[model samples]
Target: MRTSFSQYIRFQKRLLILYAAIMVFISIMLYVEPTMSIHFSNLLYIHAVALIFLMAYLTIDYYTIAKHHKELSSRWSNGMFIQDGIGAAKTYEQQLYLEMLQSVNDAHQQQLTSILQDKKESMEFMTTWFHDIKTPIAISRLILEQAKENPDNESILEEISRIERSVNQALYFTRTDHFARDYFISRTELDTIVKSVVKQFAKEFIRRKIKVDLHIQPVVVETDSKWIVYSLSEFVSNALKYSNDGGTITFISEEDSGEVRLSIKDEGIGIPQQDIRRVFQLGFTGTNGRVNRKSTGMGLYIAKKILDKVGHRVTISSKEKLYTIVTVHFRKGDDYYSIVK
Candidate 1:
């Protein structure tokens, strides 16, 4: 209300000055007219009546002129947009402003839509390319397997596996945004998924001479089996990457109070305390990455994203140079299918 009054006062200040000036001229004329019969008391009475009438006119004009200003002020204070709850424009300038704002909004929306469409097309192409490239990678691996067992063949096979992992990572990264369309939720066996992931990395295990201590019970979870397998493979790959020759990687599962926890603990060069907090951040190669020199830093980040979308929780705990344990928690009663829907 105070703001509206101030606007009203500013809008009419020029007219108010003109009115005061006319009244002053009238008073001067009445004073200087010696031949006139008007007395000083009569002049004072006339001036008082004129002042009352002027105040009445100002009150009506204030309400008439400041009505729109008051409405706009109320909307702004309440955190509403200019187009919200504001009725038809009372002036040409206001109408022009509204039309201009609407045009700009429309243009912005079109530009944003174009950008998203381009990104979707790019991801679709990349996903197709990844799939196409995997055919040749598989052929290469098969050809290498058929050859004699030698150190060179083994190294070539390892490099091929590395390429395959990289391609799969890129494919999954693209699919992350389109997860709603790609994933299906069902009652999946947790142990089966873990074994499959381990099988996928069996060569890596053998090459590193790392022992797998699987203690998983026959636990089941409601999640997308494909995504869960990929996520677990990422963790297992990380374990194999950092584990020393003849070291142990333990996989344990336990259920308590309707919650199931699956842990992958590795005896490796553990994460530094300062780097642990940022390990899951995208493209953040921490102290361990510096030591290994092969970390793309997307494995844990992608795993966490997939787990969260599946309504599962993942936590990591580590002691420097001792052990790093990554745990995935699943609640038996959660409606994970709702997330897919």
Candidate 2:
């Protein structure tokens, strides 16, 4: 209880002492001057009795209010529920306070419900649109596969591939926010994820004349595979983008300090020192990005987002004209992902 019985005594003890002082003064008068002793003694006795009744009434009233306050405080401390109010109150003021609290709680619940419904609808629409658009994309890719061998169709196929990658980026970006709803976490092979992304960019690798080197050990890590694959693909695409024809891009994975680290190294025009910190910012196109007109400024941003969500770390180290290396580190447990891509 916030207001204890001792606290009440501390407040009213002075008044009690004053009453006693007055009674003692009357008794002294009766003793020093016995002519009016009967009258003074009887008056003192009646005052003492009245004082006792008044003290008792004040003590009971203070304790009752204090007990109620303590109960209400304890209940409110448990949670901010309007229903957990001063139930069965002995006073009208407490009942009014409870009614005010209930009104606020009701409004809060309604606002929360509306926000949730809006978010649900938005997620559904994004998912549906992503899937629906993929149907035509798949059909187009099939048609391109037949005509892709023709030299005249080479550049067209490349542009179409770029389009497909952009669409995939958007779809994955949408999914990243709701990772819990769509992804499964388990022991995923690091080499396997890397190989799949490499294969997806095989044509680009050939066209760019970029030499590929893979030094990945068969490391097992707890992660969401699909998202990891997309992240690696983004890294590989970036490597292909800035590298000179016949330049080397390498993938290395190792266990370091009880964590799994994967590095993608490219002999590409590197990120300017000033832009290094801002590369991960959404829609940020650095000096290298501006030179490479193909940079959407979203690849590294999405990659970093995905890595961070799954309990991974991404760091980029580079020299002006030499090379760029993007490293991702992951721990060995499942983590629920959030806010990425």
Candidate 3:
């Protein structure tokens, strides 16, 4: 109310000046024409009455401004459209400003829509290109497998495998943005995914002479199996990358109290204490990543995003130079169904 009154007074400064000028002219006329004898008290009374009426007019105008301001605030607070919220304008200038605002808003919305369409088209093109290139990669791998198993061929095959991993990583990263369209949630076996991921990384295991210690039991949970496999593959890949030759990598699974947990513990170079907190951050390669030179820094980030989307939890614990443990937790409940829906 005070704010509206202050605004009203500021806007009516010209009217106030004209009222003061009229009073000054009347005072001069009364003083010069002594024949029209108006007493001092009567002149004071007249001035008081005029002031009362002026104050009454100002009070009514202030109330009107205050009511308009309150209505505007209420409409905005309730999330009403700006054009409708402003209500009918009382002046031509106010109407003009409202029209101008609507024009700018329309232009802004149109530009935003165009930019989103362009982005959607670009993502679709990249996704198609990745799928097309994977066909050639698979054929090459097949051709090499059927050929004689020479050292040169094995090396070439390893390079091809690396390329395939990179392509899969890029493809999955792009799809994360549109995950709602591609996923189907169902009850999937946990050990099956673990075994499949371990098999996928068999070459890396053989090349590095790393021992696999599996202590997995039959465990099942509700999830999108494809995404779970990809996320687990990323974790296994990280384990293989940092493990020393002939070192031990353990895969442990446990189900208790309606909760399932899968843990991958590696006796490799563990994460630095300072770097542990930011390991999942996008493109953040810590001390180990810099030494390894193969870490794209998107593996953990992508895995975490997929896990979060599927309503699972992943955590990491490590002591530098000792061991690193990555664990994924799946809670058993109907809430899992709510995630995809």
Candidate 4:
């Protein structure tokens, strides 16, 4: 049990009262002067001086205790306390205090463990749900493919494709936290990764009539091909999403100073300055998001996470209504890119 300030005050007050009673008794004895000698009078004066010093010490001690009461309570709760004086708590009280502190620490540890277990279970469930949902999405896409000959059916197919992309994005995002252990890094051709990612958005590029300027060389880099492809696709998709129809989108990759730089530049409505800092933050769809309500805000966030794991860096530079450039920097000897290079 914790001791209160009032209880401590009462204890100090008792000490003061006992000291005062002893002084009063000494004064009465002195007044009686029943055949006392000069030596005895000197001894009484010495005793009074000592009592005054004791009272001064007690006053300072009380003030210090009052000032630090709250701090002492917190320390006690956390299994730390200061004990002084010969008549302090005995062995039994000390043991009880230690036991109480250990119990509190054990409870705190159990609570943290329980929270972590719940989070692990939740992530596992999401991963399983995403995998299960992909089957129906595939079936719908197949049905749409077979019926694509009709113009009215084309819209349904487009919508289905969009839904498929969303589901895949969600699956990838959910799985990225575990991607580090599963990733395979090797030397991959820069052009090959670019071509694969571009192919996925071939239909969107065609539909928007966006001009593509590809300046990629047959350069090689060490990196995770799958994550690199996904990262590049996210940038291109963002470019396509923000750019007006007929706007130009440029995909450029080159090796410079032992580093590979790949950039996606779009002549579109660029991002605002305030939104640029928060673009890669999860669930942050900024000014562009307000205009394009279809943006899920997870694309850049996922890309950033995946790239960082693989030792690649992604950056964005934008001028509102003028242009936006998303750049991915690749260093040499990264497990994924090094094998490919």
For lDDT, the strongest prediction is 3
Q: Give the alpha carbon lDDT tens digit for every residue of 1-341 in model 4.
A: 44455676577777778877987787667666777544667767867797789868866765655545556666667765533111232347556875676677679879999998998899899889988988997897788778767786767877877777787788788778677557888788988888898898887788889888899988888888888898888888888888999989998987877689999999989999999999999999998898779677899998898888888888899999999999999886545334321
What value of lDDT does candidate 4 attain over all alpha carbons? 0.80
Candidate 4 weakest lDDT stretch, 10 residues? 82-91
Model 2: per-residue lDDT, tens digit, 25-103?
8667766785765665577687778778977887887888788777778777887435544567576877787677778
Q: How many clashes does the backbone of model 2 have?
A: 0
- Best TM-score among the predictions, by candidate number: 3
The residue-by-residue lDDT of candidate 1 on 1-341, one tens digit each, is 55566776777788889988998999889889887778889999988999899889888767755776777778879977554656677668779987887788779879999999999888879989999999999999999899866659989988999999999988998888878988888888888888898899788788878899999899788778899899988998888888789999999999998899999999998889999889899999998798779798899999888888888889999998899999998878877557552
Ranking of all predicted structures according to TM-score, beginning with the best and ending with the worst: 3, 1, 4, 2
Candidate 3 C-alpha lDDT tens digits along 210-259: 99999999878888999999999999889888889999999999888978
Over 4 Å off, model 3: 1-86, 90-93
TM-score: model 4 vs. ground truth: 0.72
**Model 1, stretches more than 4 Å misplaced?**
1-87
- Ranked candidates, highest lDDT first: 3, 1, 2, 4
**Local error of candidate 2 at 39, Å?**
17
